[model samples]
Target: MTLFTGLAAVAHAQGMSVSSSAFADNALLPAIHAGAGDCGGTNTSPPLEWKNLPQATRSVVIKMTDPDGAKGGGVVHWIAYNIPASVLSLPAGAGDKSGDQITVGKNVSGAAAYRGACPPVGDTPHHYVITVTATDLDPGRLPPGLDAAGLAVALAGHTLNGSTIVARYGR
Candidate 1:
């Protein structure tokens, strides 16, 4: 067993696991070099690739979030679901409605989109954690516009496995 300190300490204690290809713990955001702002910093979603999913997975769900947000402890930046099991990657800006093999849900902006990193000024860099959950249910069951809570209810007793990647964004 391992332990994480600070803001992420709670999540670690709760048994949420995380990993990434472009970034890691205490790692900087590569999108910054590509000209994207931290959360709310730009409008483009970062490109991501993942693998090593659990064998029981029938569908995959992806979500982008900034745990450090305005007055709510954390905020949802993007929610995407119904990803086919064959998909293993998402290009930058793929969180938009145009992305293939997936559907985007309503964001904090209430526009069913992926809002980029835009942390408060002068604050420590915020962590944008992108997670992929593998589920045993059919992807077609999930309708668009499901909030996190709704998605959770829909996924009850269905999650088989999951993976995650984290990036830090700050000015």
Candidate 2:
């Protein structure tokens, strides 16, 4: 099986799945969800939904990364964690600076908000991988303002199950 299929199987076995209303898996991201700068879009975060989390889950973490960004060194567009397990979805714009309920972590740009997809002009469309992880940690276990790397370090050994969706965007 493909690596993605293998991972999906694992997640399915753990009873979790994630999806977005703004785009299908492996589909092009809408311009409304692109960055507002040179990318020329509205910079709105897409709506996301997840379900069937593991019974032991106490919190959730969401991360979006552009594997092709920054000279092939991956860039984190968003990191949100410490979300109550009872929350099954995030509405559009929920990644904004003023978002509530969930703790917003810093993105690659150091902003505790979503930085929508913005690939370099003329490059092939870049893939944005968004993952939602269910963890056993309490909703308030993690502090705010942690960046992607820091979040990763904090999440070690805590993830119980997770799911991922891939969207493409380009200038």
- The alpha-carbon RMSD values of the candidates against the true structure, listed in the order shown, are 7.8, 5.4
TM-score of 2: 0.90
The most accurate candidate by lDDT is 2
- Provide the overall lDDT of each model, using Cα atoms, as 2-decimal numbers: 0.71, 0.89
lDDT tens digits, residue span 1-171, model 2:
599998886666587889999899999999888999788777788899999898789999999999999989999998888889999999998866634568888988898888889999999999999999999999988988899878989999999999999999988
**Decoy 1 TM-score against native:** 0.77
Scored by TM-score, the top model is: 2
- The C-alpha stretches of model 2 lying farther than 4 A from their native spots are 1-13
Residue 96 error, candidate 1, Å:
2.2
Candidate 1: misplaced stretches above 4 Å?
1-25, 31-41, 98-100
Per-residue lDDT, model 2, residue 51, is: 90
TM-score of each predicted structure versus truth: 0.77, 0.90
Q: What is the per-residue lDDT of model 1 for residues 76-155, given as tens digits with 9 covering 90 to 100? A: 87888888777777776676663457878887767777777777778788887788888887766688888777888988
